[model samples]
Target: MTIADLHTLTGAYAVGALPEREAADFRGHLTRCAACAQEVREFRETAARLALAVAEVPPAALRVRVMAALPEVRQLPPVPAGARGRVVSLRDRRWRHRLPYLAAAACLVAAAVATGVAVEARRDADTQRDRGVVAEQRARVVSALAAAPDAAFHTGALTGGGSATVVSSTRLGAAAILYRDLPPLPGSRVYELWYSRDDVMVPAGLVDTKDPSGSLLLQGHPNGAVGVGVTVEPHGGSDTPSGSPLVVVPL
Candidate 1:
């Protein structure tokens, strides 16, 4: 695959979605590219985190109900030879007695399936609503910081490529970072912003990997912070930086 095409496989590789031949090629590329290697590590960690986040245990009641219904769901016996012309016998009566039990079991299964679908739909709706609210709040914060009278902007070069611009406002008590020409990270990795206070790095916010060049409104106030630092972190971000800053811009 071409170099540009290979770059796009970082996500697939991290999730083990790549074919054997393609994965081998990507491994070769990783040896020569420090940035790609770091991205791969971040992607793997992100995938693990996501797996844990969405995992759910089946309800105990559901299991119990399924087990209880198993005995009631029996297979009907085949008709005996020449039985079609005979009168209803004991075997026929027994089969007739099981009809209601069979119907009840089928209804129970249908009800369970309906309940599951309804629950899933409600959960998805709630999640979407929460995301919308968060996005709206973030947009307002970013806009306010941009328009603040005391806002000051500083630019710094990143380690591998591109540059970062940090905008801090004493009036708004907040900061924002704008990434320019930044390389895209794997789905499992994110660009994290930090506030440097007394040589200690505090996680400020996470930049979306999908939009590497987009802007992010940093969390917490920028007060007492000497500067802002940007680093690559796993999907969710780190409480403290895991490595040296890719770029640090004075506040």
Candidate 2:
């Protein structure tokens, strides 16, 4: 179905008020169409909220009146005499036709509201995830610093590249990494931190202080690094060493 058709039926889809055939057809269309899917999601959200806000059922008298007013004309068996068209009052027919439209509009409004809520919920989840990453990095740094041979060395420099402050204990063995004063790497390269132990090098991780001279704090030292080294490598550090050392601090 075309986008215009979907728009016309958006309310019906939101309220689930479409005829079975029409509903099925629309569902098929939505599956293949991105725009319609988005519209349906929005409309459904709006419809749900409207339903809750209007929790009270229609008055019994109104319902009864509508039911009672249905045309009472009987349908006779197909025959020559029954073949003539029975004229339905223009006014009654018009009102009957308008009902679906009204219902659809209500559903559409509800769907819109629902979509908004969903978007907001997704945004909140993303923000929470970002915060979690930062917290996790902080923990790693704290642990590394604690692993330092000397507790005093656990302190990270805030001289300007980036700063590292111990967030938790490393008594169990972990080192926190924090430093400032270095330049930004090129697009094709990255700055990596490393820890050396007994001449064996252990890769730390990629860091981002953002400023060439800005103090960038990183997660702590590796499990057994006796010395700290910074190196430039491809965006991500390699398992085996590649590139020249940028800085080296002996333990």
Candidate 3:
């Protein structure tokens, strides 16, 4: 294929639809063309996600039915040694005409599976990298708040069990909460933090109920909030406190 033709093959290449020679040419081009490479990457990711969104599980009896019918299916008989120029049946001719298309379809299916696996792997790596960056930034904020000259600490006992410690730095305009020996909640429930200001509470962040003992840097600056409160909420958390605070530590 010409160079211009190779440039248009990104979509086909991403889906493994290119012939072997053309695909090889495009692969070489991709190494030197950053834009084409990026487009191909995006195309693959979109295709993979679309495939996953429409995928379904087959019925459990499907394999059994297929196996049962296999025994009754006829197989093509082999030709005699001297029958090279013999007339071919219409059925044989039809099968010959369809052979290439069937092979191509199989190749496409295999390519799609391979693309999905690659996309999932890349997504997982990106997620891990993002988590690491977030964790590092949180640690820095927590440390800075703890070291501030105006930092004040308050500890309160939770209503049902355990305790919560709040470290507030008015000068830094932030606070952090550390939960200790907190009891695990139901799978559908979670611990959410809030900042109380003028008797109005604003959501801070959600705590992982599975790890009862953990710490979180509240979502926003304290902004003269009176205290920090923890409460039980649905798994994704609530816009406002759904129930009374489990623990409230005055700032």
Model 2 accuracy (lDDT, Cα): 0.53
Score each candidate by Cα lDDT: 0.73, 0.53, 0.74
- On lDDT, the stronger of 2 and 3 is 3
Candidate 1 deviant stretches above 4 angstroms? 1-133
The alpha-carbon RMSD values of the candidates against the true structure, listed in the order shown, are 14.9, 27.8, 20.6
Query: For residue 178, what is the lDDT in candidate 2?
Result: 46
Could you tell me every candidate's TM-score relative to the true structure?
0.46, 0.43, 0.50
Better by TM-score, candidate 2 or 1: 1
* RMSD (Cα, Å) of model 1: 14.9
Minimal lDDT window, size 10, model 3: 49-58
Q: Please, what are the lDDT tens digits per residue for candidate 3 over residues 111-222?
A: 6655655575566657666766666666556655654545666789999998887877778888888777788887699889999989999999998776666567789989
167: Cα error in model 1, Å: 1.4
